[model samples]
Target chain A: MLEKKTHLNLLYDFYHSLLTDKQRQYMELYYYDDLSLGEIAEEFQVSRQAVYEHLKRAEELLHKYESQLQLVAKYEQRQQLLKRMGAILEESSPDLEELKRLVSALKNVD
Target chain B: MLEKKTHLNLLYDFYHSLLTDKQRQYMELYYYDDLSLGEIAEEFQVSRQAVYEHLKRAEELLHKYESQLQLVAKYEQRQQLLKRMGAILEESSPDLEELKRLVSALKNVD
Candidate 1:
């Protein structure tokens, strides 16, 4: 459950702009602000079931976006490559060839 | 019109996966393959008007994706930065601090 939350949070960061304003609002309140579903429903003047359905649909869209776009996956890949390159750059005598390969890989990411 | 085509082509490359198979096919046929709308319509046994609308909607969605995500913008930015950094790395004594700053900026790219 925690793993799913973490994944959803990362996905939400990437694709939240594609969601409806109300969906974004509910997601922020429920995930970031740690509001209970009941709290979100009450604040939004909707039934808890309605709020749950909205969140579920919003989440499904986020997953769809990820499956299609892979933006977050590409992002994580680039970050990993950058960290390795940074470590190499900090060496006294950086392996220029290896750095070049890393840069090439970075360019080809996604 | 040519500029818009070029821009849309690039956007399509980035976001085509988000579009439906039919949308992708129409886009590729119209843009990449340079098939006339009437030709595409005939190929698919649809009216030319329907083909035009599908292409229009697909193009609009591509633009919307670009506006929301800016994946192409970030990709271009990183490419430029990498080119500049690559040039420096080729020099006998690369500016380590400047390279570090570039790396840092890359890490922060959306």
Candidate 2:
């Protein structure tokens, strides 16, 4: 469940804009706000089943986007590289200016 | 015209998966494959005006995706950073191991 949430959050970061307004609202509540189906349904004045369906469809859409574009995968790869650079910098007392440049380069990747 | 084509190509690269199948077909032919409207229209069995409209709608959708997500901008920035790193490596005789690591890191970002 935690792994699913983390994965969904990353997918949301990459593709939420492609979702419909209602799908976006449900996902925002369910994933980010930690709302249950019943809660989201109540907030949206819809049935619990309706909320579940919307969330399921939204998840499918996010999955489809990731499968074709791989933006999230690319993002994670860049992040891993940045983290590696950070570790390298920690070990070496690289020059202050050079360190700043390296950090800025890392920042630009995101 | 060249600038518009370049911008559309970048936007298409980032958000083509979010497009409808028909939109994707139109964009693939018009932008990437460099098909004329009349040729696409004949191939798709649609009028030239219809092809134009589809392309226009696809362009708008691509623009909307870019405004909300900025993935293309992020990609271009990472490319710029990678290019800068390449330039630095070229000028300096950085350690072979370190240069290989940096190059691998740069390759991972893309």
Candidate 3:
């Protein structure tokens, strides 16, 4: 499982780096758009396997990127920090500097 | 700013779709791992501008994925829901069915 995750991370990184415009469109349709593989194939005038390949490759690419860079991990960390900050803000005694620092850190991500 | 953001989004998606293995490595060093641009350039034996360009392009690609599929948006929604659920769990009267449903929904994201 660890090996698989590492492989997936490598694939993810590669996918992030080297995607074509059309491939990206297809990926968005399948993953983010929540379209079925068959639907994506039809939209792209391709076979189901081709669509599957695209998605599989895309997943691989994302994983590749993640392994090398751990972007997802960092993003998750930042998110957790944001949540903690939110919780802190809800408290009666909020730390102003801490809030500012957290906000600045988040802004740096963009 | 909005136009810049849109452009960044497109770039981000494109980056996500098509990153090279080496590029992914550089990106992780720069973004998630928080390596400075200069440090990444030195490690890769690339110029500072090259590193900058790589980082810029990578950022663009991430934004593109976000805009096209709104994965970040969906993730945020899930996080918010989780927070709410956490809050609910802390409440005196917790809803068991709602908790189960929410957990099920989150599990589906993976």
What TM-score does chain A of each model score against the native chain A?
Answer: 0.94, 0.77, 0.62
Off by over 4 Å in 2: A93-110, B93-110
lDDT of 1 by residue, A20-53 (tens): 9999999999999999999998998999999999
Clashes of each: 0, 0, 40
Residue pairs clashing, model 1 = none
lDDT tens digits by residue: candidate 3, A15-105: 4445666667776676556799898888778999988887677676666555644556655556565666556555666554565465445
Off by over 4 Å in 3: A1-110, B1-18, B95-110
Displacement of residue A12 (Cα, Å) in model 1 is 0.9
Q: Which has the higher lDDT value, candidate number 1 or candidate number 2?
A: 1
All DockQ scores:
0.72, 0.22, 0.05
Interface RMSD of the predictions, in order shown? 1.2, 8.3, 9.3
| Backbone clashes in model 2, listed as residue pairs | none
Which candidate model has the greater TM-score, 1 or 3?
A: 1
Instruction: For candidate 1, write residues B1-110 as lDDT tens digits.
Output: 59878778789989999899999999999888899999999999999999999999998999999999998898899998888888888889878788878888888875
